[model samples]
Structures are given as structure tokens and as C-alpha cells.
Target: MPVPLIWLIAALALAGAEVLTGDLFLLMLSGGALAAAASSWLLALPVWVDGLVFLLVSVLLLVGVRPAIKRRMQSGKGLLDPAKALEGKSALVLDRVARHEGQVKLDGEIWTARPHVETDVYEAGDQVTVVHIDGATAVVAKIV
Candidate 1:
């Protein structure tokens, strides 16, 4: 069989395994194999070069793309909880935010906010960093 055909067969097998495993890992490898098949068809590269390409593409997908895909799949809603996702994000104080109570415009929506530290306070228009989500409130620290 041709090199490209072999790679395509490998990709098909990987995809089938992915279906059975229900994990995206094999899907990523399948994507790499597909890429290798394309390279082999277009460039007629040597077997060793095709192998290197497969490895590089597979590693990139596994390391860089898999986490985001997995997170989306696992979150069910396609995203993490808003509060958890907003951790460490910047917000603009819309009201005097003290340790007890206040409001801030976080990612365009107003949220009940509190200072992360007892002494920290934020006046309207000040920038703050979201420290964490405490119940429905955002615990924030001044950006300094």
C-alpha cells in the first residue's frame, strides 16, 4: 500500500478507537495521522519525516488543544462556572467596594463584590483583580 494510504488507515483506526474509548486522546492522534497523510500525499516526504511530523502534530494537539477541549466537554455547559472562570480577571469597581459589600462590573455584568483583604477598598472607577468567588460575591483586590 502507498504511504499516504497507510497513514489514512492508521488515522481511521485511531478514530475508531476514540469512539470506543470516548476520550479525545485518540482523536488527537487521528488528527495527527491525517496531517501526516496530507503531508505524504502533497510533499512525498520520507517515512522518517512523516513520522516526525506526526509526532510533532500529535504532541501539539495533546499538550495545547486537548485541555481546552476536555474542559469544554467536561463542563457540560461548554464552559466552567462563571465565578470560577473569572478568577484572576480584572474588573472595574462600580461602587465603593469594601470588605463587607460593594458592586463591580465584572466582564460587563455587575456583581456583588468584596475586598480580598480587610484593609483593601476600591472606589468607583478603580481597577481590581478578582481573587476568588465567595458564594455569589466576588472577592477582589486592588490592582495597585
Candidate 2:
């Protein structure tokens, strides 16, 4: 029946839902609920005030602190790139890429590739650059 207990329960429930759905929103709300519960216990605030505090704190944590923490932890590196990645670099066509089937060699590995433009055709040993990646196929363009 205590406000803190209720808030704690709500927080736990929100966190559990986040785990299930994998959405960041509910997880932020959970942090807010926990903050409200803490405010209730530490400040001995009324139930309504506790609820308001939870809302405020949750919003602050989700909007303000969470992004800062995420940025701080970020290494500016993508998950797929190990050494030089296929995002903004160049590669060479090892074999002629036909209408729907082609292969390229990049970073010493042969990868299935495709031309970005539908009409563009590439020949073997031509210099190509990785433009974009679609699933297993890397979209490539002729490097001048």
C-alpha cells in the first residue's frame, strides 16, 4: 500500500517489459519509477508528490542523462567494421558482376557484390568502391 512499494513494483514491471520488447522508452520510464521510489523513501514525500517526482526524474534521466551516458560509452565504431569496414571505402572487382550476381575483393576477402546503379556493369579487375551494404550483398560503384 506504500507509495514507494507501488513505485518500485511499477519500475520492476516496466523494466521486465523492456526486457521483453527491447524498446528503450519503457526502460527509461523504469528508471524514473525507481527515482520516484527513492524520492518517496529518502524524502518522505506524499504519494502524489512521489508520483510527480517519478515523472520528472524519469523524464530527466531518459532525456538528459541517458543520452550523455550513451555518448560517453560510444566508441564511434560500427559493429560490422573490424579493421576498415565496408561503409565508406573502396574495393576491387575480382570477377565480372552480372545483372544479379557479382563478386568483389576487399580487404583481402572476396565478397558478393552488386552495382548500385541498375544499368552499370563492371568487368573483372576493375576498381570499385563499397558504397552501401544490403544484407550479404555489398553495393559497389566504379571508382572513376
Model 2 root mean square deviation, Cα atoms: 5.2
Q: Among all windows of ten consecutive residues in candidate 2, which has the lowest summed lDDT?
A: 75-84
Instruction: Give me the displacement of residue 19 in model 2, in angstroms.
Output: 2.6
Cα lDDT, all candidates: 0.92, 0.84
lDDT of 1 by residue, 71-124 (tens): 887878655686788999999999999878799999989999999888877899
The Cα error of candidate 1 at residue 31, in Å, is 0.7
- Kindly report which residue stretches of model 2 are placed more than 4 angstroms away from their true locations once superposed: 21-23, 70-75, 81-144
Cα distance off (Å), candidate 1, residue 71: 0.4
Show pairs that collide, candidate 2: 32-58
Among the numbered candidates, top TM-score falls to 1
Per-candidate TM equals 0.53, 0.50
